[model samples]
Target chain A: MVFQSWSYVGFLLITILVVRLTSASWRWLPLLLASLFFYSLTHWGAFVILLFSIFYTYFTAIRVSGSAHMSIRYRWLLLSIIGQVLILGVFKYLGFFNGVMQGVYALLHKGDWNDWPLLVLPLGISFFTFQSMGYVFDVYYKIRKPEMHLGKYALFVSFFPQIQSGPIGRSKEMMPQWTSISLPSFEQYRWAIQLFVWGLLKKFVVADRLGNYVDEAYDTVGSMGTWVWLFILVLYTVQLYADFSAYSDMAIASARMLGIHIPENFAFPYKANNITDFWRRWHLSLSGWLRDYIYTPLLFSKKKWKKWAVVYAIGITFVICGIWHGASMTFVWFGVVQAMILICEMFTKDRRLVWAEQWGRTYQWASVVLTFWVISFCFILFRADDMYQVAGVLADMGQWNSSLLTTYLAEKNISRLMGILFLLTMFLWGDERWDRWIKQPQMSMNKSVLAISLMLTVLMVLGVFGKNDFIYFQF
Target chain B: MSNEELTARVYGVFRKVFKNEGISVHRETTAKDIAGWDSITHLDIISGMEEEFDVEITGFEVMNMSNVGDLYDLLTQKLAE
Candidate 1:
């Protein structure tokens, strides 16, 4: 069931009520069952697959522990990673890979292999697969031991709130939270409710509203002007943040209702002065996971590099990360551009500001203008249908060199510029001070309760009334 | 270098790389064993060791060196030659 579903909401309400009514283990038992029921609503068959994955890895880990030699241990570790990736590839990327291979084969006159049945994309397969694999890999590396208990392990993988979209909680982070059988405190409830409300505002009011313009511009297929495509792409940066962060905000808040404290998933991503800062802020859990598992391993594995080599690894990892999102050329180029910009920054150090300073006031302001435009230009790839569309969009953007500023987009779309401004300001403002604002301590229980109640009321009116799914669900 | 000298130098590298001067060093300590040590900070430590000692490290050794003692042994063997 969707977090936004009426049945789910009703179930959750009953859950909150029952938790308040009971104590200790008795309280969480029904909640755990309810969580399973929530997961089963999506695809019961796939849920069985999920259960099998959990069981497979759990047993595989225990079995691997029985092995004697380091080579045996390494074999088991390799098998575990290979099994999980193969499962992910079949469920998530078989179609993706097939599509690519067909095109490549057709070009070579080997003909397309079109006989295979389309693979059904499993919901939350990416998330749960990663979680299970992380368990085995960590055990193999001896970073952490496998949990002897099955129930807590199951709860870790299928924690319904996180099973869908994740802050990609590590075994180290979430395992401790699962150990508890406690009640949600009043403060936790208040903060959870506040986070839920803010998340709703982001998803429904902001994201759904922005989706209207983006959909309109991009839906026309190949006829869309180059400038218009670029416009939608920049707006996507806004859409993506709203979609994913909203999911994370809700996930964290929902976990909080169960007396589980989850980590914060987003920082102020757009306000990032550099791509490095962007990684620091954006989809933090996934980024952190990639760093620990992917980037660091690759970086340290390579021999020591000259100054340029450090920058090269930074560029390479970002590009690889970008391609992992999709096989599209747009994604590839966008990733490379972002990495290149970041590499450029590594060489500049404080010299960037120094150059601006030496160039005086007009040049400094011009630099800021240049910086913002360049970043926006890179975002064009993320928004386009393909690289061909990106070319068309970039070409259209160039044509506006002599046109009036007011003609940047259609008349109706022009109204949405206010939203763009709002998004930009909020993002820039969020970086330095939004966390400080939200974390401001409330004075009393009653005041916190009242504030949360009012915020939930607003969310009920604005957020829950819509039919939109959380944007990060697809990713 | 003796194990004790190697241990102290590796500990110094750890403390400096992680930027926590007050960290107590021990042979059994992993990255998580130390308070406030994280992946990014650990990379800083590895990077610092490479530059300071002028010795190259394999990715295999980096991954396997979970504790202070593991690093100390690896450094001692490399520095010996």
Candidate 2:
């Protein structure tokens, strides 16, 4: 059922055809059924959990909006959010908490504690929970009205294109689109196909090719030299962005073919000159959700704390962001590192602005390079399985062995690796140029067809079709 | 205060918080329209508005404000109260 597969292609085509043939008012019926069918294919148990979440959030939202008293509305909002958090905690963090307890027992030299049986993490549990909880929050704040239709609400929560990994749709944006689904026009379909093909090039050709090297380096981190570690750090960052954003592009394109628009997830994040700018551009939807729901409330509630409130908000928000990623300490550290950098940036904002004015282009270029390295180093925590592996990787960085670099260079696939890197560079360059051209109204259909054809050819020739699951699927 | 007076005061708060005396905001002005108006500086603006108008703004009201017009409306209601 993965979007990258041929079977998914057939499923999407059939679903689109059926929806198009269905009456306008009833288009949602086929889409809802298809989305549920898609989820059910993942796991029946997880599907049941998703259904429960939809029902619980749906009913809770209605109750919140229905309540006349502020206290009552607050209570319901708190109850619903806690319920969602508890569900996420059990499914996603039980093992993490259990490991902490085991460490305590081992420290006391007691008998080994039995391991807890971890539940299967439903795919995209984090995404759906956050999305649904955001809906409830909006209702409480009166940002948007609660959708009274149960089926439409269910489709909003479980929409197949975004359910697995999201550009996390808001109810206000997505609910209205469902009530009036229509077939995409010829131009729209052409653009969507071009988008999908481009995503395929990124995922199959660039990401997977790079993933090969990243995996091999991490697999033998203890034996790697500094040069190998450097490559690992940089390559893993690229691999992650390519893999996750590729998924988003395809998901958006799939939804676009149905004339539904999801939010853009990435915006040339690597071009950002600072950590703050990077967050604004990277994983835009999730960051928006966090800012609106978590950070804003936390900061406003403690506005009297002044600058400390910003620090506190950044710290707490990113810790939650980290835990939202997984039940691992590595992820927590990842969040902590980002929060620390952001806090530093906030305090030094004025100083940096003055430096930007003084140093001009050189300062901006230096800032971008520094920010990229900072992010790449932080991603080491993201990529490592455990602290021990992270330690091993860092320790390997001190081994300055030129012979190892020479051996790596002499590997048989070096030419292919270089070719993939070239393609990756070209893709990034083309993306910037495409953004500039897309805003202009004179874009020709012939150009789109040619671009799509070229991308498909490149994908066929170079794509590593090992059926790699998108990296974000686990989160 | 009149609506125009309230808007002018709001613009003053924006200028003070962002440290740009020449900054201009319209009814449609959003965070994107200003250089330093982001999530980090947003609280400063809210606090600045509160200080300027002597009104307490809730998170609910803040969340509802999408543009300067919405903020002007919120301030008008708060001032009326």
Candidate 3:
């Protein structure tokens, strides 16, 4: 069940009540059972995958840590990582490879290759796998000790709130808290409810609504003008940010109410002035994971290559990042485009800085806008159906038709569009404005009542109850 | 080398890599304590230290060094060996 659904809300309320009422010794029982129940909601078969990941990584990590010989530890680490990657490959990309092979056979004039029936992707496979594998890496590297308790480690892997869409908690940060379950404080509850309210509003009022427009545009991109395509790209970018960050916000808020703290995922990414800065701000958990686990090792592997090593590492890391998203060539191309832009930014860093100094803040603002547009275009690669659609959109960039807007206005009220823009601006630039306003120490009873009333009003008006799956669930 | 001597050489490497000769480091100094000591600059510093001290540092070892003090200890131990 998705977080935005009433069923999940009811489930969470009951779970919170149980946690609050239960003793510390038996607290993991309820949460673990709740998490397993949540996973069972996805597919009964998926639990097998999650169990394999948790047990395999858990056992190997302990073995890696206990081994005195570097060779033995390294072997365990390699085995664990490779095994996790293979599982991810089988579930996430096997069908993708089969399709590519079929195309190859067709090109070679061979008869059709009978493809096996595809397996359904288990929910949160990417997230839980990455998190568990990170723990194994940490243990092998001696960065932290592995948790010996199976239940706690399993909770770390299958934490219900973040299981579907994650801020991707690390074992070191999460395990200690999982071992010690406590009732949330009054202040924690207050903050959690506030964050939940805001996240719900963003997802319901902004992201889902924009999703409608994005869907309309993407479905008809062939007939849509350049202006329509541009609008769709911008809307899709905002929709993605809103949708994914809303999931993270809700996940983090839910965890916090249970006295758990997950990391923040996004930080005003559209405000980033360069591709490098953008990566730092966008999907921060994944980016940080890639930096630490992939980029660092690859960059350091061949120091003789010097700065070239950074470039190569970045390219490879982003390609992996792309593949981690899905098993599509478009995703791979998205990574390639991002890597190329970043490399260009790197090569031109000195020149750009000099230009910035000469031209001042305006140049920097232009860079920010340029970066946003570049990202939006790359996201087209991410969101488009195939390479043909990508080529069609790019080739038709110059074609403009004013009728698209006129027709939109004829169909929908301009005031509603203005309202959406205002909401999007607040959601983007003033993301935490409501939270900050609510957390004021001098908050009066009347103000609190008014805020609650406003929240209820928004929920009743804009919240879509069904089809509430978050965008990142496909990963 | 003594701890003090090893720390001095480490300081030289940090100064050159971070490009700030005046920047001071101590036992508790971490990435946040210094400017431009982010992930990318971190590799440059690691490479600089390796070149300066002629010690082979693995990625695992680098990951384990929480602060300058750990690096100093590792370097001194490696140098003594």
Q: If chain B of candidate 3 is superposed on the true chain B, what is its TM-score?
A: 0.91
Residue range A411-435, candidate 1, lDDT tens digits: 6566568756676567545634644
lDDT against the true structure, each candidate: 0.70, 0.88, 0.84
The candidate 3 chain A region of ten consecutive residues with least summed lDDT is: A434-443
Q: Please give, for residues A1-475, the per-residue lDDT of candidate 2 as tens digits.
A: 8989889999999999998899877888898999999999999989999999999999999999998999999999999999999999888888998999899899999978888889978999999999999999999989999999999999999999999999898988899998888788887887778778778888998788788888888887777689878877888888898888889989999998877888889998888899999999999989999999999989888888889999999999999999888889999999999999999999999999999999999999999889888999999999899999999988898899988877877883688668766876776557667544432334488887678778789889888889569989889
Scoring only chain A, what TM-score does candidate 3 earn? 0.95
Clashing pairs in 2: none
Winner on DockQ between 2 and 3 is: 2
Best model number under lDDT? 2
Individual DockQ of the candidates? 0.33, 0.75, 0.64
When 1 and 3 are scored with TM-score, the better candidate is 3
- Cα displacement (angstroms), candidate 2, residue A215, comes to 0.5
Model 3 CAPRI quality: medium
Candidate 1 accuracy as lDDT: 0.70
> Which stretches of model 3 miss by more than 4 angstroms?
A403-405, A432-449
lDDT of 3 by residue, A1-475 (tens): 9888789889999999989888877788788989989898889778898998999999999999998999999999999999999999888899888889899999999989788677879998999999999899888878789889898889999999989978898877888787668888776677677678778877887788988888777666666667767777888899999889889889988988877788888877998998889998999989988987898888878656777887998899999998899888888999888888888887887798789899998998899999889899899888877888788777656667788667766666888777777877776677556546854545655766677678768977987655568889988
* Of 1 and 2, the candidate ranking higher by DockQ: 2
Candidate 1 regions with alpha-carbon error over 4 angstroms: A17-32, A221-231, A304-316, A327-329, A332-334, A347-375, A401-410, A413-435, A441-467, B1-81
What lDDT tens digits, residue by residue, belong to model 3 across residues B1-81? 666777788989888887788989999999878865766678888888888999888777787888998988888878888
Best candidate according to DockQ: 2
